[model samples]
Target: MTSSAPAPVAWAILGFCAVALVLRLLWLSGQVRSSERLVTYGLLLGTASGLLRERAVQDGLADLGMLSVGLTRQLSTVVMVLTFAPLCLLAISWSERWPARQAGISGLVWASAYASGIAMLVVGTHARSLELYIDRAEGWQTPVYFAFFSGWCGATGVLMTYTSIKELRAGDLRPIHRLTYLTILVVGAWALEEALSIFVSSVCAATGTGGGFVEFRFRANENNYIYLLAGGAMVAASGVVSELARRLRIDPASRAVRQLTPMWEDLIAACPEIPRPANPDIRMSSRRRVHRMTVEIRDALLVLGRYAEPVPDDMGGHGGEAVQIVRALRRKQSGAMPGQYLRLQASAPGRDVLDEARALSKITKHWNDARKCPEAIPSLDGDRAG
Candidate 1:
């Protein structure tokens, strides 16, 4: 049978799946646990399976002698089945705190189920061609094969739906996390669609009737399967995008650390009482380093408080604070005697360490510029002599 031209919606769904596949791969490239990797791989495979359903992709594979329509269908089905194993593991992992041994056993069981499904597909179905399968060749094996496949898919769908719903019902989920679970629900729906399609097709084939409500419903579900898969993939991709965006926002902490380093060093050097971190290693993430440095700078400011001179109200911004800090550093370094302890404000009020770092970063910029133009910094001697 000649393959029909792909509909516009089919192309759109395929395109969406392809993009989601790329995004999931990129997300997997970052730091992830083994279970996270498994789930991500499953998502990638599911998206890929959706893409494989496109007539264009099948034709391309056929052109390369890699896949005929029949083989493409089989491969897509197998990959989708494979996708559920990892997903099943993910659902189990998410639903409860299982011991490693229990988790491993669960994974193995899912793997065995996936293998069983593939074995049935290979051994039970005589027809490898799509036309033969769809045309309802007279055979008990075909019905049995579909029955097993449908049952496996249905079980997987039920598990996924259960897990997703349970997680979504929790009160503490962030909006993005809630969205991710909702997408998993969509995936579960897709799985159920597949199960229904397979079961109905098998029943119709067995009954030798292809032109009624049963056939119409089967065709409708079959057509919707790829769209459902694509929708799930797109939502999952959005979750990945959200994660990446959050990381991108945090990544600037590294730059902030670098910017504040000179100011931090100057303060620490002048106030030798400031204790350094024990493990000042490169392995620390940017956010942690920024927090540590912010705390250290604040402590150093307090230690050098006695040498600090109050800046005029007119000079009260970050640049003014930068000037005050610079003068205090000079006074402390010059061995000036402690006077009335006046606390110097070096940064604006901030909500968190990252915000504090950003505030301090502005001071560091002004401090660096003042050092380059020494005349811009008010002298400690001028303050001491006053």
Candidate 2:
């Protein structure tokens, strides 16, 4: 990098990197605690570092008077690989089942990639005069130094592409998974370009065979086309990831909670103590709030069950999930101990709670409607008798 500005293409890529960073940060906010989470984190940090390097070149920071000449440029360039090395580790570890063997393989490969990145940056720093330009036939360190960084990128690309393909073939594949595969594929193409550039440039430098390659208008002797395409792919992947994150979002509000809301409110209104918070943390999402409310209501219903007049004919046996829960509530109210009620509860499983809630809602809806109109039903004096 020199005092002169980098090409317009680099500037455009940097702009895309900024967007990618923003999207990755949003993705990280989600609740997925898996290896893919680590991958997204690494991508965020790496893209930010890329932006740092691009800014160093775009602004010609080497020419600044207050700062040491070439200091910012070198640091930014080094940071590029430093930040990306972790992504290599995370990418390789993205498989569903990480057995001991797979874990060991990923660890060794990550170590190699990270060490090579560091060694590359160090070798570049110790170069003569710190001049950024190095033609294919010019210097030994340039090709060798680039080879280290390229190797890591190539390895990472191969791992991610393989992982994405497996994910694509997974049963009941989702929209997010598909977009994630697309992102990995685009990045894989970019990595191939980088590897090809290293091979071609190193060959030219080694054999002293210099023919005209597809050089850039601004950075002559450099494969600007490769970088341009790579940067564009990254930007596209960023958009795909953003869409994936949006699609994969888990709505905190559960359907059970929504249908049970009116019933829950009415029940708690009669027995205020039933609505006690399960946890002190008030910062949970709306869905969590609904779940907590559902729990409280279940407890309250058990108490109400104690006061249930008798097992109505329609509610006996496996009439309906809702009535069955109501019957259980009545059983609990009738003098069944905690262990008895818990045994019944465990039989239902968590998945059926929503159906139970819906049935309970119907009962509450009738009660509320009657309560709203005095003439609709008989006296509601013993509704909360328990």
List runs of model 2 lying over 4 Å from the truth.
Answer: 1-48, 55-60, 64-77, 96-114, 125-132, 135-137, 214-260, 263-386
Each prediction's TM-score versus the true structure? 0.60, 0.54
What do the candidate models score in CA lDDT, each in turn? Answer: 0.69, 0.52
lDDT of 1 at 10: 68
> Model 2, 199-298: lDDT tens per residue?
5665565455654552331153123432643554474365456456445543324444555677576556545556475555766655566667667777
lDDT of 1 at 23: 70
* Collision pairs in model 2: 136-205, 252-287, 253-287, 305-329, 305-333, 306-333
lDDT string, candidate 1, 317-343, tens digits: 777778777777777777777777776
Which candidate number would show the highest lDDT if scored against the true structure? 1
Which 10 successive residues of model 1 have the least lDDT summed?
A: 377-386
Error of 1 at 35 (Å): 4.0
lDDT agreement of model 1 with the native: 0.69
